[model samples]
Target: MSERTTFQDQPHRTVLLRNGTVHSPADPFATAMVVENGHIAWVGSEGAADSFADGVDEVVNLEGALVTPAFTDAHVHTTATGLALTGLDLTGVRTLADALERVRAYAAARPADRVLLGHGWDASTWPEQRPPSRRELDEATGGRALYLTRADVHSAVVTTALLDLVPRAREISGYAADAPLTGPAHHAVRAAAYDSVTPAQRAEAQRAALARAASLGIGSLHECAGPEISSADDLTALLALAAQEAGPRVTGYWAEAITSVEGAARVRELGAIGAAGDLFVDGSLGSHTAWLCEPYADLADGAGQRGVCHLDAGAIAAHVIACTEAGIQAGFHAIGDAALSAVVEGVRTAADKLGLARVRAARHRVEHAEMLSPELIAAFAELALTASVQPAFDAAWGGDDAMYARRLGPERARTLNPYAALLRAGVPLALGSDSPVTPLDPWGTVRAAAFHRTPEHRVSVRAAFTAHTRGGWRAIGRDDAGVLVPGAPADYALWRTGDLVVQVPDTRVANWSTDPRSGTPGLPELTPGGPLPLCLRTVVGGHTVYAGPNE
Candidate 1:
């Protein structure tokens, strides 16, 4: 029998922290803090710490480190993120030959009979700018069941052996020779590959991913699991782990478009916040499956073929209504303009059916609404949706000469992921890495938003940081959790920072100047091209889940 992992209950005690710059909402430069009963008890300058420390159970000197609330990754695939770390990682293969060589090396290293699973291959960055053909992958893997997903997770390249094993794959749509499998075919083949992995392996992968999140100073992560991304059993195991551990908290999102009474009942039993996130309204742009306003500029085979739209207005409206009535958040994975348009109409329909106040109070969410028309943006604001976004998308494939430009033409490409516009419209924004798709780099994500390629859409550093930290808590209706003031949850990170500088958009795109009037203190310098802070410790609910050398 597999042993069940159980977390020991922790008894709270008073602990005093001193000689550090506290990045609290109340006081940014506070040199002392007191945590007790699993919550922040006091925060002040060092002058008043001695009195508070007099009877505390323990006293810790922070040694001048920076203290702030630990990050909340608004969207993540837990098992997949962890598996990527332990599996063949092809994050930055610069040439086609390099990719082929890596595949060859990886396949040789694995057991002869074991199926090979890998992710993070973007042909756009390579010199050839193309993925390998099925025959090439079959030659590389020697007929083993091999599946290498694209960087966007929207499509994948699989060996013929794998396709033969998945007999249904041949009957599914979106199957093309020498091209990545997308739409239904991609989903089927991908499922078959992962289905071979044992439950123990899945558990281990989740544990590995959660450990990484803790080490990265993340205190909470929303598991965006669904019928498409993962099974109900996977979500259960993950939520169980988070509840029992002294680690990053997990808020679950089961992505499914509710179609029937049975489906609504199943969603409530999934042990998640809502049936939202990655319940695909559309596919990703990288795979040419994202529901776009017009035909992709690079489309060669299918003349005038726009991307796929999985859900129409009626389906979206039905899902939204069911979720709203159930008192759970409703969201969709929308990247392109057509998808966002569908989502907006759905939300509007739900509001009309179930009073706008009821819908707004539910605080429904939408993931990766990357392309939005002004009308759609206004609708999102009116519906009060949380835009769960990944800044690294723009950082990696957002430049004029990058993949997005090639896919949608330069003018249209530059219009995607309008962070400032969304924020200015009073829509709540939650930033995340989307894990294997980007990476679990919170500071890197912050930098990307502040230094967007299009200067006009860049947000202030504080706003970007707030969106990442506080916006995540707000995403799932946890308004009291993200901030670090007295009476808040004792969840935070300690960092070893360097010369602190603030960035502002100016005449030269980035002025790299600190503003005295801003009243913010000592954030890591976020120039267009700059370094990020290294986290030394991470604390969740007054418990240290990760401690670096200093402890």
Candidate 2:
């Protein structure tokens, strides 16, 4: 295997890809595309491709493959995802004992690690229904400092030794002697753990993550980094690596609250696109920290134990106004109803003060957005707020017997992730994996949304596909990318697929869309149990980032 050349090294390449099914709005039945100088110069039928056949520098015979715009994961934690890929992953450990054993073995295997870091443990499914205790973790790792985060990344169970690294963590609001830490405590411990990672290790993890994404046909990624989630140096390093490599394009969002133009400028200095991403308005439901209108059915702590609220409506309003004035996108991580309500109130106040058009023009986004009301859905459309969502969340924790139903009652759980409502109400949707929380499976994500556990919330596969692709580009205020149209950036993937067909949740619409006269460019069959298309090649800005198997 030879080292792959990056787009930066081959800036002016001209290539023609022919004999493939091209999914383009410009030509629904197209089977060819021409790329020149990192942009789509032309896209049409096989006959039209003949004119450019003798003129291109290189010609790729796609051999009847399916070509579509490469996917854009709207929200991701790059370094964390990489670490999970290269380190201990407790994603499906059903027993508490198994999780502990995995931790013990992992610790023994990596004896020289400064701070042991791992993710994706959900105690909700454990028979004991509890996370490993600090003492248990101490014994598991022989008192080694360890930070193991929950699947949601909102909380963690840290060894006492790790807590000693951050002495003030004990004073944080959500800290407890034995229970998993939340809020400031979790953030503090996570920082200490990640800070222990050397620059070389971090770079290797990031490269592994980008390579995995490229192989999965992901052409762009929205890095959701923050002071609490990840450090500024981490984001800078990842961005530099992406810029210097041939992998997916990475757009970084630094989740910091801004109250002045100076703060916004400082965010720009960090090489971030906006002061947005995982700006926590609240926490996650699994951690029992998401701000809710009502108390959790499972917790009997008190009458008013309805999750935690990190930011009030006033603080949210201040940030929105500041970001809007500075011409930067602002976003919040709001899951529960109360947190979402605060976001709506704050954005509405900003709209009132800055004029609706000015505020809406900023196109600020909200992450997760799982627990939404009809009113909130309307508010998102009115304010032009992009709902950066993860359908995998629904697939993982939804249904009557899952974690969501255990947290909130089954009825309320069914209402979570209202994709159909959001789409019908005209809210712009950008799909993501929130990788490490859920694995990055683009076709699986589309299937999850189309075949939602709660049927009423289901969206068409085409709609979900668009949300994962072009919607991500639109979220970052780019309209010229993430599509197969001429003049668009040449970021696309070639997939060895079965047959292209229209798949929709609604039978009436499915009947119409499947008809040839509808002119809808078909996608692969995304039935729940069906196999997804395999990527043959992935190109970013006209350069091949990944060529699978023998390609």
For TM-score, the strongest prediction is 2
Cα error, residue 188 of model 2, in Å, equals: 1.3
> Which candidate achieves the best lDDT against the true structure?
2
Model 2: residues with Cα > 4 Å off, grouped in runs: 1-9, 301-304, 507-514
Candidate 1, 43-77: lDDT as tens digits? 88999998987889999888988888899999999
Residue pairs whose backbone atoms clash in candidate 2: none
Question: Can you give the TM-score per candidate against the true fold?
Answer: 0.96, 0.97
Q: lDDT (CA) for every model shown?
A: 0.86, 0.93
Error of 1 at 524 (Å): 1.4
lDDT of 2 by residue, 58-155 (tens): 99999999999999999999999999999989999999999999999999999999999999999998999899999999999999999999999999
